[model samples]
Target chain A: MNNDILVTQEIGSFRKPQYLSSVFRKTSGPELSRLKEKATLETLELFNRAGLDNIGVAGEMYRWEMYEHVAASLEGIEFFGPVRSFDNRYYRKGSVVSEIKRKNSFHDDELTFIMNNAARKIKLPITGPYTMADWSFNEHYKDKRELALAFADILNEEIRHLYGIWSKSKSEVFEVQIDEPAATTHPSEMDLVVESVNRSIEGIHGCEFSIHVCYSTDYRMLFEKGSELKLHGYNLEFANRDTNELGTGSEHRKAFAELKDYWDIDNTKFIGIGVTDVHVDYIEPIQLIEDRIRYAIDAIQDPAMIRVNPDCGLRTRSRDVGYAKLKNMVDAVKQIRKEY
Target chain B: MVKIRSIEYGLYPRSEHVRLSISKWERNALDHKSLGKLMDAEKKEILKLFNKSGINFYTDPLINWQDILRMVASLSLDTPFEKISRYRETNTFYRQPLVESYPRLGEIREEESTPDSHLPGSMYVSDNSDHYMYFLPGIESFVSMSFLSPELNRERVMDSFLEIYLDLIKKHGMKRILLFEPYPDSHFYEGNWDIFGSAQVFYVRYGLTEGSFSERKDSGPFSLIASNEKEFDVAARHSEVPGIALMNSQNTYLENPEKLRKSATKMSSSLKLDEIFVTHTEYFDFLPHVIANKKVEILGKVGD
Candidate 1:
């Protein structure tokens, strides 16, 4: 698999093994760590077999839901009952009670483990400050902007710590994907998203940062205002809104039309184009995956600026389906690279 | 002091029993009849709580509804709904109906056949009992959530839908209806407000005026939800509506009854209206059932 032409990466999360998922919240201390490590290794092996160039945190096995994971780690945040995100899937939302402070490191252990064990490059996916603020109840801060900036400070510290861990092991530039699923949900809050996201990676140097936003109704706000963000790339979901028909034309690939809008405003950043729908189990055929990537390549006009990934996270799909989807995605990229 | 009244409208949270039963039914482990029985029991319990709490005018818990728009669309509209879209900015999602063309009022009548035929039986209160509010999506909200065909005129569709809803209300003997418009801001079309002025309808707006709470002149039969003290102050001064729901129902934190009562009393004193309705803001579906129950009890105390 050639990484130069187009890199195939696991964007955010993969479905955890049954053993770990069954007792994820029940077990703790050494037992929990053992199970998480075992699951992470297994997931890494799966990504390796699927021919992925960059495995993101080995499917984020060390965490549960993105917002809750970070919220649970911080001070002055109390989790409420589970709320439905989509379908039957639920995540417990948290409220900021007082001043939020970092109580513990969110991804140090996972990054340390991945850096030591994984043979491939790793991209650490952290829930961005804008998302954390948006998903939470803002009782403490004067406004959501203030709360998001507060989270940005906490994230900056956590990212600095993670960067320290990664730099010690390898001199290669570490990749940090700030996952902000709520980035474009509020049209008026584009400036806040930009400010908070930029604040998150403010002082960190020698890191290739990207933002992963999934299922946005209108990405025009993000595309128009995305130039202000201090990010090197954008990993966004398009397959969820696109059709499965095999064609590279604009009508057939209507969702990727936004890629042109994005490139028109700013073409400097690499875009991780989501080639497969992760919500459903229908594994996109290698040919269909190729068309999506080709459509994106045509829009961006540079194969090097495109990265191939699933729409969002594979956690919603089973391991078998997730593996098959990624396998097809990798195969699609391999086929497209030959043309280059 | 202005007379205080307590009421609630919107989807309540499902109990663990109901939620689990739904999951089981989806997996084919439980039958539809069995699931219905469980949801009925939960609804009864919620009704009993409302009665005991002295909340006279109440809404059905809507325990069985997936969202505010889905049930109404399925029961009323002839247009086929397609994909599940995110409901407002909340984590919950609903099946968005695709409006291919301007729906005719006659089409709604044909779809319903009879007024009672289209109404969800569980949503209706007993004939002998006191009136209960019915929750429906506002025309603007429905249009916003729907997938309108590019060729269709949006204003015509909205007007037709409004007529259809008004007709339904008249035939079904729905006394009070809460039109949910959960926009993050308070800006609503002035034209729609003129139409709603003629009906016994209250525009329930959540996430009102994010940073600065602008005084909305002649809000007209609306209930503004104030989650915090800052919003409460803004809503108290600016809201010309007869009622204002206090405390965020989406949050699970059990608000102190004493603090809530103090805030309610303060708010009541400032409003010029003779009486005001105090209730929880947003739907209880965002919270767990147990937490929601406690919040209900707390609301009772605050209104006292």
Candidate 2:
């Protein structure tokens, strides 16, 4: 097996530090600002402590969920009394009204916080156009495809501003991970999904465009149309679907087999296989992580293109569980690196 | 004569079927027969709920209809490879049309794969239901017609489904066809001339919004699937057709009908609806509450 493959990064959103949870109720003012800054610093330090190769700038520190962060950054979005939530715990964002427009490119405060606090180059996770449109109740757009493309234009403006911000930091490889949890739900719109995504990243040079999906999806379709989008990699959820299946030859080795089938056909894009399951609180043993990684390498037969990460964000998990999982993952990668 | 009136649509709750069975099936815990049995039970329950709710015309409850792309491809396309028709997803799963998959798009004959007769035991819900049962075909299935030849107009996609409709009419004495179109604005509907002209064509869009309920004459009278009074108001004002007010039980979204009472009362007083279909077909024990009172008859979609 080729030993050049590297395991690096967290998917995005880490668990909120406990110290700031109590103070989150303060909607605004100097106290909220100070707490946000503290959370940002603490999150960056945790990344350093965990030894993640490609550090993730924690978007959670700002206290907005994935889609809401993008919603908050834009103009023409009116917040109604209605609040939508997936789990009814960590996030509850106001349901939107009116046509979403680009009032500003990106959230300058979040960008500034990351620029000041991040010790290394970061992976910026932006909610993709397809997902943004899918999660919201549309008030303005006539067609679903049209709404998605308009969001693409909005996201593109944000990406251009991000490019300008990161350009000053000398971060040559800016990986902008587009989170599209809604793509698979609307399968017939796959063409529009890819097209809108491609449009969002158009003229975005110097940055690596990676599409991240938290659940199992049509990865093959993404690759079949990858040549057009020119996607650099895919961060997929595997471990959560089959937590018990580990190593190369387990009888229940469906996840790895699925990955192998995709790689056997299209191996051009980088594959970041999720070694840790984020839904549960269990801290994966370092040995299990080693086995999962080895099994993935064995399945794909190319270690050069493989990377390691969690199934999705650890926002739901406790801060301690999240950190423990990250450290174990990092340690396992180090062990595998030494063996090679 | 009483107009043969009804609200026609289908509901596939993720909690009850696809996510419940297939995830276990993928892990080899549930065998194919057992999976089928489970789905059959689910359908029976869904239909029972529909019957109780007073809905007359409804589509079959398809548990794993998401795999519809593959199913339709296998039944409608002349392609040999099953892999081409498989459902794919990274964050989510959906099927692309055969036109997107085949490079020789213009050469294939999809009609050749059209069965000589309606496939028996295809929709068990339709076979067993007491109401005017209908079957659903994805919009992508219709687009397969455009792949039949090089000079194919986009309208031919709609025409292809018309052929399927006629075949069903001959074989099963089928009365109506419901097309599950999530995004109706994206496709061409002109080729559906004969079907629209002669047969009852119910274009079912699952989640209703005010934007979907339009004033334009081209936007066909919507059988609005609303969960709240706001939506009911939109439907009442814009509907050139009847309205289907979805009960909270049928939707993942939670809305207070109590909160909707004021608007529902106001709209009912002003708007003259030809018919009103109260539908919540997913819950077996669900009995829909009448939300509107007007001079016109507010009927259950079909029967009690």
Candidate 3:
């Protein structure tokens, strides 16, 4: 019951658009090719150092999520996932649009297959319908709202198919993570995105659905309807902020208690708060991690549904930095549990 | 008079050169490539006359190389580039060790000795990485989706040229030195830099010594690093931050006949150098200064 959900990036280089371009080389030649190879191997090293065997190919070219695929490439360590190659942008031959349309195209499905094949717990993530619309330039739809809803439909289709894949893969994938990092930027789509998510999961399934909203400095508004228009849990960041300063969450801590006060905030609709920060490359001390954990526990007063994790996905950190933070996080939680 | 003038030398990514970009990037760029090349072709063209010109102690050209020559040299072997003194790592190449030795195709590799003494001090070359081979089947692309395979042995590949590059710098004549060291892109990759292929810095035995271009014999070509400036800076700052700066500016930029005649006027000025270096033209301009302050070396590029 005292378990907490956390959110962090692997390294921020993958998944995020702005960071990807930096990894490119000028000579677009063999030198560039060599650099790409270097980046991949380096990422694996980072993962191993963090004590995490799983790596999600965040969806460029390497199938880092599948154990067998990356086993040899990674020198025999398992922990990997696929990047759902769906897109709201240009429908070029090999673009996101085509990848998403493929059968069992969602990351959830791929991750499920991986989990089943490797006999491991799976982490299924997707760019929420609304977030995808907000970050991408939509051409197929008529208006902004329409485009978001249309994306919602596409996502709904993927969710249904993902359930099917889980069954076929023989893996019980209950964690359905809808990554809505753009939740703050387009709060307008909040309703549409939430609705589409609800609609998608309506009849198709019985899985623990979670929404990952991050990279935003503010989430005060999303706190109001913590219970309404919801799925399973909301994995939000309370650490990796705009600035590198630690021990703070955004500019105002005023809304800190808002989510805790929400009605029906329980084990079903969990609130995954970041206990450690991944930005600035500074790991959280055990005391700080404990404080964050305590804050969530006291505010919510419901340990059963509290999910504590790093400020966000540590996709951006080197292996040492990320793992140390997570290890501290897990340790702090255990400390809290002992006291409880 | 065979006067010996002082030369100042500081490695790139050093503390002194750290803030240089913040200040120097604003200076108006001269059309040195065109007019100077024309001047080299035996034409007369005076340029950038109004601004006060001190000898260039550093050049910020890219290390855009195909191989790991410069990274292996300055960071691993302690060998400086020939003519120009900047670092880069993409689309770069190396000339033969000496006038007779054949040039290497990719990165420089060290064979059986210390490096600084072996390589040439200067040479004119171009970025020559082949893209087709990079795009070959089985190569990785994309972050989460694009997959690639490591094509070559980073160590052996670098050493192949190290042997010859060091020998060349030690023996042959050099005009401008070129280095191919890459700055981390994920941190600052807008406009000025256009790199993305290898995003993370190579690290090794000790810890996170990534991001910096350091020369260490114990590690060979291995770097102790992560993938950003802060980490890299820490590593570089810790790597004995080479002192004893020396700049030997003899025939760097002022070798032309007319430029030589023109520089003769400034010769009467004082060249009080605790440490100073210049191209050949700078030597002419500061003749009197060199006589007064006394530290002038009419050495060829890189003293090779």
Candidate 4:
């Protein structure tokens, strides 16, 4: 495995282990909590074993399942049965039925757990505010803006709490990746999205801030208009569309081609290029990943301004598939390092 | 007189009957035609069950539009549509509203607003006679203007919908349009009051707006879907205006029907709501068994 890449991280979430899932269903309160922590440590150990540069303790924290995680934590939000969409089931719009109160802070205990157990720096993913508001049914707040801002305020408190924990531990936090998968859908609300994001990260310092959009998004709108947003990096899905573009002779690497648009954004310190497509089962060849990385670096016209990651989290994939994908990604990065 | 009408928010069902079909479709085992037929049947069943809930107004099942994304997608966005925009509702579920270069108001076809029916479809609901049909040309500004340039005014986004209503009013004598403005907190306006002012024009002197509530001086009574005590307090504070309370019956409120009943009971006692709208009729599917022997009756039937 290549250790040449500065950071090889799972976006967030790994598939819940089968034994743990069974134990969770069978066990009660404290026993279930104990199993969850065990599973989290095991999950992180698996990633570290996979030789990952960054690890996140995602067990039972709802890693990057933005709305569900927030709904599980916050007061006033109520979740119903799966609302059947085209093919998949989503938790019905979590209605804000009461005044939103903090039931518990997010990631503080999880980060503490990670710091004590893991050798690598932790990359904690907090679901961004826009996603929480956009996905839920706002029965409480007056508008989407208020709903999002309320989520932003809650998230800010959680982030601050997390930062305090991290500071006290004095452990390395690779970066805080704010997952805003909903940002690009409603372009008109980009202003609010930007404002809400700024609110979520307001005043917290020392930790790097990265925004991860798990789909092909309106980067031009987000980066161009959201220039005021405090950010250190932008992670987006490229391999989901450009998997076919991996062919050496392929003329148009359409996903990477859009990188030219974001080349001029001043506030964006780096682009965490998604080189693995998490949606599929096929293990992407190291050569293909190397090609994708090379194309992003070439297209963006900077080698230092690039990091490599999967198109999204691998929680959906089986553990075997997820591990294979990460191992391949790291190997590809190593090959690139050798070539360069 | 002010009337309280129940409005349904459409999130499709996954009953045991449709579960296999859904799974098959997800696995690509079932084609679009089969899945469409299965989903259409499921929606009909859902609506029928909803009708039995004894609410003031019945909203026909509207499950086909896969969230707002699929709802907006039926329209023909201008050519050279760039697919850069995406909204991921879940890990797997998402909608990418393609950027329409030349968005024309005329591009919105009639079938875009209609419920799922294979009968060479028309614009209006199949049976608007029984209940106040929730009609719309397209989703409001936040979504309709999503793909359009961000600089455009929210009013401009409402223009096409306004024209559709104008035509409906002229042709069908469409009296009351149920305005479904979902996002009132977007700072698109200051509060629910502000959203009501801009949107009231579309349904002015004629229809009902449920999602975002406000007091109307020129039109019908003020109405709102207050799910909790605070929202009820806000609606009650504005008690000077005659209005109806449309309580959200979905979510955790539905799990414990007793809680919902208690809230509704207390709310009605505190404020004289002209009418109470217990929303999301599908959740009430279990109501028959639950309320079978119970004397606590929070819902009553209404005949229009």
Candidate 5:
């Protein structure tokens, strides 16, 4: 392993194998567990082949959808019919009818399985409190901020439980990435996001915390108020809005210009820069991915402060395309590592 | 006694059948004409529900529209939208428009706007001589969803679109227009209310909190949409306007029809208003077709 290279990690989710996804909801008990394990094992092998420094829960196979997964395991939420997120993909949204309490440990099985089987380092991605509050219909709590704080308390407990399980075997810091796709949508609620996110990771030591916010129109607020968040890094999407041109110039890499804004606010936190777009099947050339990373490295001027990944989850793409995208991203990092 | 009226505006969700057809059409399994037929059927079914509910005005279900902003952007001649962004705070997404210059309006075909023409237009026609209501994104909302160039004049761009929309309303015989403005606190439309002159315009503001109610003055006749009773109370206390929309269209959980009717009656009686419109606070597009259908029935019952 090249220690000098920037850490390359899978952000949140990957396309599950047909054998697992086809029967994910239909079967339960040992049958579903067997299939999820099989799929996770396969995905771990694929990540290993892609030369990933960190595999995110081996493609998050143990859970179905992020919102539905957490909401289903909670006491107060009631599942309504499915609604479209984008394209044809739909997830069953829930309404918080009462005070939310954890009905079950959300990521225990996945994390336990990864610890036993995986060789590389692992990062567990949990849906953040702000996103949980934003996505659900709020029928409870005094307001969205209060509901978010309630969720933050629940998440703080869940993370502590997961950390207990991970600490038994591992001496190194356990990684936790809070997935908050709705983080920057409401610019006025940045304070709520900061407060709730800080509360989620409150007093949870020995765990490196990060936030994954994908496809936002404006990330300035997140960066501006980022110093207040108790997170170690931010994973954000850029390639979806960026040009594919292979250049490090200001005009060539228009989307990466936000790195300057981020650097202006705080330069200490790492950025898991998304180099490939997950919404399309077109495989970004290695040079294009290299230009994206090169632009970030030039702006930040630190290899350790930069991480490379896809714009968002690769669940939207087919397995082959996702694997190819990751492979190219890793290869780009490798080519750039030789310079250091 | 205060006169009670019911109406609905904003995009209604597509049924499973229509949603499936669209998915298939995207994959090349179904043809465009076939998909159009499916959507047309969906629109007709929604229209039937509206007529049976005895709504005083008819609005397009907009089942085929991707979102409010995207539909509005489609009317632009420059193809301003480039990237998909989240629609406000909702899980649904739309292409964010980037307006570099003053946007010129594309030609509006008579078939596209006239009540006697195609699917959405046809949706506006009723058996009786009922008024037609059209839903549009307000000026602030349009600016919020887009990236305006530094050189572009905001008021000029807003005025241009507003003028075209007014012309369309007059030409197509649309009696009412509801501008969907979710964020009133932004104050993006502070000095631009006069352009709506003489048009029966109602600004629809949803996702409001108690703090937001007192933040802005009532520029014109507008309606406040509340998702719950507490919000309804807040709106009641703040609104000196004639009408209010009080229901949550963003969720799938069915509201208690009896409770909703009672609440509407009590609010109307207490407020001593001349008119009350019982409808969803936001776009019904956030819901499933079956649930939205049920809510429409409840809306009719409340108004009755």
Candidate 6:
């Protein structure tokens, strides 16, 4: 696959540490590093089974969403937020440097210290710029779309900087993925979303681009408009039964495929089907994964056109369940590929 | 603990006179199904229906009609609402429209937030029970209120509608008048209209200390806010009974109707508003329930 397609573990382990604000505990660094290393090991093993040569493992966290409040409460300070919300679920603070520095510091000192030795691609997960902007109170712009585009402009610069780091690290592959749970809520924003994405990804060539849309119900609402947005592929829920949480079932899969078909899946785009169920404790057998994969491929009417992943970020489930689910999914997909 | 043992009895009518008035005439504008067996097939039974109604303060004469159009239809740019074109159908409603959606705007959404959003002029309940009107079985926190602008009447046709209404009330004993929510496009909604009104439109604003609300303080977002903002952060609080009134005129609200009766020895209070009205209607079957609520009192005969 050359360096064009960086394989997982073929690179190095991913880093994720519980970040603390400015205060350092005596054993904090070591404790963080140990956890990160364990997570990296689990990730590599799962990706290896899933047949991902250069896979990266990461987590989703709620601590960030309630950041200002969390920060205030933890520090015993009353806080509305660092960023006030126009609606909610977003903040309007922190510069790119500060954000990256904070993230990298936690990943490196606390998480990376142990995680670094493990071999895998260390990917940085960011809440997509549009979602970050959308979930926050907007101003200095007339239209919401304009605000989103402006946010995207700043984000594009941020991604370029991260990619520069990947280049200097001497790593064969470095990746960045945008978590876009809010994309589906304001489907009316879709008219200009594709153009905004192009602006964000402009000039950042050679790095794989991934956009994940979550809180799956948004899928049902803005599906027709969202399918047309420009992105390497989309990651969505396909099997959650909980009504509160987004669920993607056979019907939803078919609906997505239908919209994608309307968008004309002409080799230029790829669709990622989440194969692992993020909810519930029971493990799905490899055969069921195989069946779901078959269903997705059939529904899309194209095998090469699909990419497989978990229903959502693994941060939600316990570390063991997350690890097992990922391993099971990858294994099943590998078997399905062999049969094909 | 303060032993606040206060005597409680039903409040008597402030007026000593037994007020008796009936709607003069009733007519509907909308197309309605037949009231075939409901009206007189043999010998002018409607007159008999009226004769039989022993209308009193609590007894209302059933003047089935479309009141707003009779009053303000000419003001509307759209087609003026015509009569129901049918049915003197007997309808009885237990729920008051005024207090429908209590503690939350104190009114229902006019069957579905469209048809009734304004207040008409003075309208009183009829007490005769020979025939019944509709008894809406929902919440009744509102006393239907409406206001209309004069900008309408591209042809200035409203002048003629007022004539029809005044004549109807005088002749058919029209105790109530229906009014359209005066703000343009407030009365009708096909959905996606930028100009529809809020829950405030359904309520009548009554301030006792009022020079007028605009002339005083404490009137927040509910009073002078722009319609464009589509916001009313400040809820309206009026001590007057009907939290919000509805199109039906038979209802009124008194926060403590029971408390008004403490002077019963001097005033000889007893009759619930129901006690003052007609002899028929099933309201008596639920009499115990009403009395229990402290909403009504059975004062002995007025002058006995």
Local distance difference test values of all predictions, in order: 0.77, 0.58, 0.37, 0.57, 0.77, 0.35
Worst 10 residues of 2 chain B by lDDT: B287-296
Question: TM-score for each prediction?
Answer: 0.84, 0.57, 0.41, 0.61, 0.82, 0.43
Which residue pairs show collisions in model 1? none
Q: lDDT per residue, candidate 5, A1-340, as tens digits?
A: 4555589999989999989888988999999999999999999999999999899888989989888899999999986577877545678778888999999899899999999998888999999999999888877777899999999999999999999999999998999999999998888899999999999999999999999998887888899888899999999999998977778898999999999999998877899998999977889999999999999989888888998889988998889999999999999999998887
> What's the TM-score of chain A alone for every prediction?
0.98, 0.91, 0.67, 0.91, 0.98, 0.66
lDDT of 6 by residue, B1-304 (tens): 1111111111111110111111111123211222211211211232232223221112121112122122122222233221111101111111111211111112221122112221121122333332222121101111222122334332222233333334433544433222222122211212211111221111222221222222222321121111111111121222111111111111112123223223222221221111111011112111112221222222112111
**Candidate with best DockQ:** 5
DockQ numbers for every candidate?
Answer: 0.25, 0.03, 0.01, 0.10, 0.29, 0.02
* DockQ of candidate 4 compared with the true complex: 0.10
Report the C-alpha lDDT of model 3 over A51-141, residue by residue, as the tens digit: 3322433222122222112122211111211111110001111112212222335344235434433332344665566665554323234
* Candidate 4 segments whose C-alpha is farther than 4 A from its true place: A1-6, A22-28, A58-64, A84-86, A171-174, A248-250, B1-11, B15-44, B50-303
Query: lDDT per residue, candidate 6, A92-113, as tens digits?
Result: 2321211111112112232232
Ranking by TM-score: 1, 5, 4, 2, 6, 3
TM-score for candidate 2: 0.57
Candidate 5 wrongly placed segments (more than 4 Å): B71-81, B98-132, B138-140, B147-242, B251-273, B276-278, B288-291
- Error in Å for residue A276 of model 5: 2.2
lDDT tens digits, residues B20-109, model 1?
Answer: 666676666766556666666677777888778766457777766666765566555566465566776665666677788676544232
Ten residues in a row with the worst lDDT in model 5 chain A? Answer: A80-89
Give the fraction of true interface contacts kept by model 1. 0.30
Tens-digit per-residue lDDT, A139-250, candidate 1: 7889899999999999999999999888887999999999999998888889999999999999899999999998888887887886788899999999987888999999
Considering chain A alone, what is the TM-score of candidate 6?
0.66
Q: What is the CAPRI rating of model 6's predicted complex?
A: incorrect
Model 3 residue-pair collision total: 134
TM-score of chain A of 1: 0.98
On residues B75-188, what C-alpha lDDT tens digit does candidate 3 reach at each position?
A: 222223332111111011131111112224333332221222222211122122110001100001001011112453433333334444444433423222322122221211
Residue A318 in candidate 3, Cα distance off native in Å:
1.9
